[model samples]
Each structure stands twice: as C-alpha cells, then as structure tokens.
Target: MKTPYRLILLCFVIFLTLEGSTPVPTEKTSFQWKWKENQVLELNEYHNVFFRVGAKTVEREDKNRVVMKPKKCTPDSCLVNSWFDTYIRYGKTSGPFWKDKEFTSDFTLFRNGRYEVPNEFTMPNLRSFPSFPETPVSVSDVWKLPAEESFDFNSERIRVKVIPEYTFQGIFPWSEGNYKGNCEKITYTYPIFYSKPDGEKMVPNVPYKIFGFASGTVFFNATRGVPEFKEVKLSYTFIYPNGTVQEANFHIKGIYFLRNQINTKDKESIREDILGDLIVGYTGDPNGSKLGDRIKDHNNDKEPNGKNLGRITDTGEIPRPEKDSSLEKLPVSVRTSEDGIVFSLDSILFDFNDSKLKPDAETAVAKIAEILKKYPDREIRVSGHTDNIGKKEYNRKLSEDRAKSVLHSLVDNHKMDEKHISFKGYADDLPIAPNDSEENRHKNRRVEITLVLD
Candidate 1:
C-alpha cells in the first residue's frame, strides 16, 4: 500500500553500509534477537505527548500502551502476534477523559527493533525502531542505520530515510521487574530539517519548513537477546509558509517482559484484565496508504472498526482441521501453522500473467468465504505471492492486484466482512519452495487466504 511520491527528496537516500570505524573491545556480541517457538513477550508501554500553538499548549503525560508479541517468527520477520493498546489521553488519567479503547492487529516486527507503522503527516510520530547493525557490536562501537519514517503528504506516501547514529554503550549489570542481570544498552538519535523549494508554494495542512530531532536509549538482556527497556524522546516543530505554526513533543517508555513459559495464568485475557479495560477496535495500518490521514482526522478519537482494513493476529495456538472437518476436504492446501489456518491456491487460478481471477477461481474463493463465516471472530488476510521470474516491482504489482481480486470477491460477491480482512503483496517474500526448477517455481506462485483464528 505504497503511495507513489514523485518528490524524491534527499531524505529518501542514505548510505546503505554500516560505519564500524571505531573499535575498543575485541569481543563482540550480536544484538540480533533470538526466540523459541511460542515464546510470549509483553510490553507495558507508556507515552507522553505535548503540542503547542501560538499562545496555547496541551500535553498528556500518563498514556499507556499495552502490546503482546508471541514468537511466531519466519525466516524473514516475526509476527507481533497480537498488538493492543490504550488510546492516547490528553488530561487526567480518570473520569470521562479516560479511555479504554483497544485495537488488535498483526504488526510485522523484525529481529532488530523497528515499527513499520505510518506516522501522522503534520507531526511525524511513526514509532520507528532505530535500525540495528546486522553484525555484532563491541564496546565503544558506533554505526549508522537508516530509520525509515513513513508519512503521508497530499494523499501520497512520503518516506523519510534518516540515519540514526547508534553507539554500543556495552553491557552492564541491570535489574527490573521479572528480569535481572547483565543487559546491553544502545544510544541512538537522528535529526530532520526540510525547507520548501524556491518555486513551490506551501500546501494546506502541510508544513513548508520542518525541523526536528529524535533521541533514545534501548537496553536488552544479554543472555536472552531481547530488549528489556527503552525510552525515546522526540521534539519537532512544523512551520507552514502560509498557515499556522505548530510544535510537538513526544516521550515513549516501554517495559518489556520475555515469557519463556505460558501456563493458565499467562493467557492474554488475564493480561487485559490487569489493565482494567475491555474495549477493542481497529488497529494500526502499518502498510496502510491512507491510514495516516484517517488517524490524524481523529485528533483524540479512536479508530472505528471495520471501516478501514488492518492486520490481525490469532489469539492462541489454533487447532488444525480435524480429519472430518470441512477444511480438511477443501480443494486448496489448508494447513495450520504458528500464523494461522492458511488456504493456499495455485497461480493457475488466474490467466497466464494476469491478475484477474478466473471464473472457476471465483467459485473456489466463494467456498472459502462460506467457511470463513463459521469463524466470525477470526480476522483474515489475503496475500499474493510470485516466483522470481520477472521484474521485482512488476511482480509485486501483479501480486497486489491478484490479492485484491480475491479480497473483492470474498467481500463484494460473498458479502464477507471486510473490516477484519487485510491483503498484502508479498512477492517472493515467503516462498513455499525454491525457484531452482519449474515445478518448485510453480509451487511458489500462488495466493494464500489465511483465516487468522481468534
């Protein structure tokens, strides 16, 4: 869901190589994350947001963010299994001002800390992770990694690639609730400055001049290779050439827990109960094209459910279809994995090199829609994939089109719920087989409709 932006500012380009010019310690430790199957990680996060106008300033300092991640990692990324957080509040933490709003979503997280979610245009605050070096780090190590901060400008995508300089502060003894012992810390920060070109006039709701800085520190457990604590502070101001001037500041803090075992007391419901909130709705549209605008329109309002599509993760380990279950006898390759129940359909469902669904393919999808109705509580994702046979972007576009076709069939023709369904074009990202032979390549070209169980 990338909006084609014609403006390729200097913000979009940076050195792709790491700068390990400084060295102090010979021994090194890789900061890449390691996780076991079904491991659960929790983040009891809190946030503080501040805004300023000509003569007025409004700030909220006691906001809470609740996140849950179960280690369902593929080779490429990890499913932030289920993400739910409270709405941002502007005043006292109690009374009508208090909100229990929640949205469950599937946030794709990499081994390195980073969020793929889009940020608001006027005030850029996409919770992006400071990129980590692929190689290990030693004491006094300094490196550069681009933090891809995505935004929407005039209804199109404006991606900012800023280099966040990171320094490995080395490991030190640390202790926190449920986690204690040696932990490694990294300090990171990046600056932003933008001004309008000479000939262009300022656009409404967009800043012609921007200046900002982001600084943060992250600590990870050395033994477990996971972030145990993080604190980020961001301050920025957007000055419009024709309109009003605005300033914003945000502070984010997170307390992370790595749960190695899950017993009766470790269920999500229990965790939700601890928060004393029971509301849920739409989630962050990380790859959402217009998601930034939709959220900005709300100000402090919660995102409505079923209106815009978002990713959702299954609740617990869903059971595989039984021998006599309807799915076990379906025409597609139906299997249950750490993600969910995936329905894989081969590329033959479409015409050669075409994205439209063949008439018969529509029928097959209609059947899937009927079965999907049985699990009304579950969320759904329709992903299109292709083999390595053509231009990468072309293949991605084709996959996106094909996946949308299937999604439309389920929603329009079968009247399936669209609110809980999202589609993505993962061209050659998660391949089922290698492209070494024609047979394997054929297997790689397909569309998968997953019934993400709740």
Candidate 2:
C-alpha cells in the first residue's frame, strides 16, 4: 500500500512538471518599410526628366572627300526635339515697344550618330574646346556613327567593336533689354541659326522665339520715340554619348534694350504669375484637370493612370493581440478511481460573454490535440460557467450551450475523437469574480478545457 501511494504521488509530480514546462505562444510577424518617413516627397511633386539615345546610323556618299555628301542610313536618320517655355506679363496700361532678343545656341553631333555605350567610353572634356561656353543658351545634339568601321559583319559574333566621335558648337549673340511706360508701343524679333560642316554645311535652320515686356514707365517713353537695346541671358545644354553633359551660357547684351524702367512695388509677384501662366499654358495644367482625376479613380472603367502607389506592405501597421498564459499552457490531470481521468473546469478559459476562442486560444487547442494524439487513451472535459447575468435557469442553459459550442468546434474543426470528449455547465453559482463592474462581469463568463489521463 505504501509503495502504491508513493508511485501515484511520483506520477502526479511528473505530470505537474511537464504541464508547467510547456512554452507560451509567440506573437505573429509583420512587414514594414526601411526608409525614413520625412524623406518622401508629396504625391503632387514633379520628378526629373529621363532621356535615352535611340537607334542611329550614318551614310557617306564618298569615303575620302574633303566635302562629303550626307545621306540617310539605318537607325541613324532620326531627330529628337525638347523644348522649354517662359512667360512675362505687364499691366494693361503698359502695351508698347518690347524688342525680343535671340541669344546664343549650341549643338553636338556624334561622329556617326550612334548610341553611347554606358560604361565603355570616356566623356570628352568640354574644356578642350575654345568656342564652347561654360554655360549654354539653347543646346541640342544628335548621336552619329563612328567614322571608322572596326567590327566584322559575321552573324555568329557575340561582341562587336565600335568607336564614336562628337562635334560641339556654341553661339553667343549681341544683347537684350526691356522698357515700360508711355502711350506708344513697338515690338522686335530676332532669330538664331546652326549648321554642320564646320559652319560650311548647313542643316535646316531652327528658330527660337523670345518676347519682352515694356509697359508703365517705358510706354510713355516709347510714345516719344525712344530707341533702346534690351539685354537677355540664355543658356543651352547638350548630352553626349559618353555620359557627359555640356552647358553654355550666352549674354546677348542690348539685343532688346529699353530706354525706360517700369515703376511698381510688385515685381516679384508679377514674375511668379507670369511663370505660372506659361507653365500651365504649355504643359496643359501640371496639376491635371478633372479628366485626369477621373482617370486616376481605381474603380473607373478606363485604364489606370500612370501612378506609383508604392508597396502594399508599407500601407499601415498591424496591431498585436493580447497575451494570456492559460491559452498557452496545457492543464494537468490524473486518472480517477471511478471515471478514467478527471480535471477542474475554471472560468479563466474563453473570452467574456462569448463562446468563440481568441486567436491565442487556437495555439492552446493545437497543443491539446498534440497531447491527445500522443496519448490515445486520454479524454477531454469541456465545461462552461456564467456569473449573475440573469436568472439561475437561464444562466445554466446559456452555459450549457456555450460548452456544446466549444466541443463542436474542437471535434469538427480540429478532428478530435468525439467519443473521448464530455461537457458540463455551471450557472452563476460558480462565479470567479465579484461581478461588481463591467470588467469583472466579463471574467465571469467562460469555458474551460480539462484533459483526463487514462
């Protein structure tokens, strides 16, 4: 008898130790962005322009002539145009002689007008040229093929050898100026020209238009027949195949000079308004119109607008669920002399006034399943309880219903053995809290699980 009692006590101690050693469930993982929050720009802001050199081919009429006839060749005979515009507005009273000045221009032609290889060729030094300015007024360029052919025509060759040449030029003009005031008005215009063959061979002439504002003070002076030169500053830029960019600035002094100056305290405001008007006029409202807004609507039937919504993982933060020890560890039990095994049913099991198990409780259920699978001789007791929420009879029925719900979920969803499961319900008599406040009331309603060891 003493040995049997000792053995039973040892088994109880081992069971308690194993139950306490079970680990608690851990939190779930989440995703987040790596960059700083303030560094990002507003959705409406503008980004820089990206340009690429397209196909290029060159044709020569004769190989060894001082003056060669230029002809169109494969992939090379292409033209690209880029443009910028600005505006200037004067008061309604100021409508008179405002001479527009044509400033310096620049151009760069590749040897055979070919695309520049990204990392292979070194950029040409802009300082090497005397005629090129440190800044440009208006610049344009074309990539041409290399003057020499260094690669074979074999179709099987994996790599080809190619060399490129570049021709750069800059133009600086006389002057520019503006005047306002007087009743009379006048307007003048100027044009700039560019050509190939060292200024000897001429491609078609391209024109740049400039306008001036002479009003208020200069308008009166213009009525008196005053002659003046208005000076304007211009800048041009060209990009080469070797990844080098060259810029030239020219000062056409007195090209549109004015004899009088306008009198006003709102110079800066006027300038900004003019600039805004020009940008909108040319770009068709940079902020986009109603049509653009409609197009951007995700649910619209039309195609999606060009917009980068960023990654889905970066949208918002996910909240973490509450932790509960009872939901993480399994309950300990021992075999009863009458029944197979018996355990207690406490009010610390399910959520307040609810039969559904919390997310954390799922882990506890999973662990119980694992144990039952290991010990096929075990049984489970699912019991429910309620505090003093209503009459004793109603409370008892509600508790019983809650207990049945938990058992059904375990047996149906978790595929547990139905024959090994039993349930019990306790009314308000089994209150775990004082039931004084809402918080305490929540603790009074719950369903507990007890494993019976065979």
Report every candidate's CA lDDT: 0.58, 0.30
Model 1: weakest 10-residue lDDT segment is: 5-14
Off by over 4 Å in 1: 1-26, 66-72, 91-97, 100-107, 112-128, 151-158, 173-182, 195-203, 260-454
- Cα lDDT tens digits, model 1, 358-425, are 87666567656777887664557788999999999998888878888888888789987654466677
Candidate 2 TM-score, true structure as reference: 0.24
- Compare the candidates by TM-score and give the number of the best one: 1
Q: Could you tell me the C-alpha RMSD of candidate 1 in Å?
A: 19.3
